[model samples]
Target: MLTNFRRPRTERMRGGGAYVEQRTNSWAALVGFLLGRGYSAPAIAEALADGTSDATVRKMAQRWGLPAWGRKADGFIVIPMKLRDRATIASRAAQEGLGQEEYCRQFLVAGARERGTFRSVVKEGLDL
Candidate 1:
C-alpha cells in the first residue's frame, strides 16, 4: 500500500527590491540627453564621434519630441521666444502673407544685410 503525499509550494520574491538598473548605451538616449542639455544635433553628433550623422540625430530628436537646438545643417532655426512675441510675429507674418518660418528668415536676413554683417557671417560660419 502506498499513500499519496503533497509538497508545499514556495513563493518567489516579486518587484524590484535591491534591483539596480543598468545604464544603456542606446543612441536615442544619448541624443535625448544632449538635446535636453541644449546641444545641437551637429554638436551632439560631433561629441558622439561614432560615425553618426547630423541628419540621423535630427531625426531621432524629432521622433522623441526633444527640443533640438538650431544649426545650419537643420536648414532652420528654433528660436525660444515669449508667447506674446510669438503672437506678434504670427500676426505680422499673416499680414505679409508669409509662413512663420519664411517671415522669420526674411526678417533676420534683412536685418543682417542692413547691418552689413550678413556677408561676413556667411563667409565665416555663424557663431551659433
Candidate 2:
C-alpha cells in the first residue's frame, strides 16, 4: 500500500531478515502501484508513467497484497512480515515528523545503518 506522500522517504527500507518488497522506479512510480490496489484507474493513469496502458493497472491489481520481495505461488511480489513491520514503524515515525536518522533508529536498533549512523549521511555532508 502507498504510505502518505507527506511521510519521509527514510522508511523505505527496513532492517535485515525481511522478505521481498515492491518498489516504484521513482517517487512518482508508486502511482501505478497504489492504483492497482483499487485506486481510481483514471486518476492513477493521469499520474503514472508505467500506466500508459490499462493492462499495467490490471497487472498491478493482479499483484497486489503479495509480499514485497518474494513471489507467491502465482508469482506476485510478497515482502516478509518482519520487513513490513519495520517499514510500517518507520513510516509512522516519518509521519510523526521524525527525520531520517530518527526513522532508522526507531526501526533498526543494531544494523549496519546504525553501526555507522549512516542513514542520515546525505551526500551533501561528504565534503568531497
Candidate 3:
C-alpha cells in the first residue's frame, strides 16, 4: 500500500497570509516634539540620554523640515524693517561696494561699540 505524504500547515499558513504592520517610533515623535518647541539638536540628544548624538538629532530635524544647527559662524539675526528702509540699506551698501549683510554687520558693530555694548576678546579689524 502506498502512503500519502503531505506537510503539516502551521497556524500562520492556515491564516492564508501574514499580517503586515507598521512599526512606530516613539523616539522620533519625542524628537519632533522637542524640535517643534525650538529645542536644539544638542539639547535633544542630551534630553534623550540614549547615546543619540547631536548630529543624528540634526539629521532628523532636516528630514522634518526644521532648521538644523549649522556652523558656529552661521549664528544670524533677523531684523524686520520697512521696505523703504531695506531699499535705503541696499542703496547704501551698493554705494559702498558691500553686500547688504556686510553693511548691516558693520553698522551694527559700529553702533554697538559706540554705545559701549560691544565687548570681545579679539577686537579691531576682526569680523564680529
Candidate 4:
C-alpha cells in the first residue's frame, strides 16, 4: 500500500525554493543596490552590458516605482524654469499644499486644455 503525501507550501510556489529563490533574491538585491546608489535603470543596464535596451530598463524602473532624482516617471519632458519663476511656483504650490512637481504637472495639463491638445486627444479616443 502507498501513502499519500503533499508538497510543502513553499515548494508549491512558482518554483521550488532552493534554485529559484537564490537567483531571484540575487537579482532583486542587485537591482535594489543599484537603485539605492542613485543609478538609473538605464545606467545599471548599461553597466551590466546585458543586451537589454535602456527603454526596457526604464520601464522596469517605473514599474518598480523607483525614484529618478528629479525626473517624471511617464517620460514627459521637464521644462526648465528660471529662479524667479521657480520661486513663484514654490509660493503657489505651498499655498495649495502640493509639491512643486505635482503643481507643475497640473498647470501643464490645464494649459494643454487651453491649447486644444487635451480636447483633440480626447476626441481621438485616447486616455490621457
Candidate 5:
C-alpha cells in the first residue's frame, strides 16, 4: 500500500494570534512542549485537536494539571503525593503484569490521549 504521510495540521486560532497543532510524536511531550512555550496545557491541547473537543484536555488537566498551568519553573504541576504513591504503581504493575518501565510508558500514551495529542497509544504496556 502507498500513502502520503501528511504532516499534522496546524491551524491559526479563531481571532488569529495563537495557533494549534496536530502532529506530535509523544503526547506527554506535546504537553511539556506547550508548557515550555507558556501555553496552558488545555489551550495547547485544544489547539492541537483543532478545537473539536475539550474532554481530553480537561481530563489531562484534572489528572496531570493541564488546567492549573502556571509559571512553576518545573513547567507543570508535579504529581501530587496522593496520586504518586508507590502502592498505585504496584497495583498497576500487578494488573498489567508489566514492570515499572512498561507501566511508565503506558502513562505516555495516557497523557497523549488525555490531551488529545494522539488517537492511540503506540507503546502499549505488557504488549497486550
Candidate 6:
C-alpha cells in the first residue's frame, strides 16, 4: 500500500521574514550543525534562510535537545563571586582534579538539571 504525505506549510513571520518550515529531522540536523559549531540563535535563524526570530531557533534547539548553542566565549556570563565561593569552587575542583572552570560548569549543569526544564533558562538568556 502506498500513502501520500502532505508537505508542511511554510509561513513567514508577521513582519515578513524567513520562511518558518515545520520542524523535522533535517531541520533538527541543521540546528545541530549550527549549534555544534557555536552559532548563536540569531545566526542560526539567519542561516536557516527563514526570517524567524532568534527565539524560534532557541525553542527548536531545546525541542531537539541540542547542546549549548553559540561560541563558548561569547555565551558565558561573568559574575563576581564572593571569595568564599571562589575558594569553595577551587577546592572542589582540586578534589576532582579538574580545572576550576570545568568544575564550575559541571556544578552549574547539575544544579540546572535539578531546577527545571532548560527551555525556561534558555529563554531567559542564560546560555551555557
For this target, which candidate reaches the highest TM-score against the unseen true structure? Answer: 1
lDDT of 3 by residue, 1-128 (tens): 10221222212322355653221355577777667655667766777665779998888677779765456545555566889889999999999999998999988877677645554544878752
Give the TM-scores of the predictions, in the order they appear.
0.45, 0.24, 0.42, 0.36, 0.26, 0.36
Per-residue lDDT over 1-128 for candidate 5, one digit per residue giving the tens place of the 0 to 100 score:
10222224343334465555443446545555555455554456555655534556546557765445444453432232454566788788889999855686677667766655543544556432
In model 1, where do residues sit more than 4 Å from their true spots? 1-41, 46-74, 116-128
Instruction: Mark the 10 consecutive residues where model 1 has the least summed lDDT.
Output: 1-10
**On lDDT, who's better, 1 or 3?**
3
Candidate 4 residues 1-128, lDDT tens each?
Answer: 10122211221234455443322444545656666656666766665454556686667678888777555454444455689889999999999999998998897788676777666546665542
Alpha-carbon error at 18 in model 4, in Å?
A: 42
Please provide, for model 1 over 40-74, each residue's C-alpha lDDT reduced to its tens digit, 9 standing for 90 to 100.
66776777665678898788778878664565454
Please, what is the whole-model Cα lDDT of each candidate in the order they appear?
Answer: 0.65, 0.48, 0.67, 0.61, 0.53, 0.66
Q: Per-residue alpha-carbon lDDT of model 6 for 1-128, expressed as tens digits?
A: 10122223343344355555455566566667657666688766766664668898888778878776355455653556889879988998999999998897886777687666555445765543
Instruction: Sort the candidates on lDDT, descending order.
Output: 3, 6, 1, 4, 5, 2
Candidate 3 structure, TM-score to reference: 0.42
* lDDT, candidate 1, at 112: 70
Q: Model 1, 4: alpha-carbon shift in Å? A: 70
Off by over 4 Å in 2: 1-24, 27-29, 36-38, 49-51, 65-128
Better of 3 and 4 by TM-score: 3
Model 4 clash tally, residue pairs: 0
Q: What's model 3's overall lDDT?
A: 0.67
Q: Which stretches of candidate 5 lie over 4 Å from their true place?
A: 1-25, 50-52, 65-67, 70-128
Per-candidate RMSD, Å: 18.5, 18.4, 19.3, 17.3, 15.5, 15.4
Which pairs of residues collide in candidate 1? none
Error of 6 at 97 (Å): 13
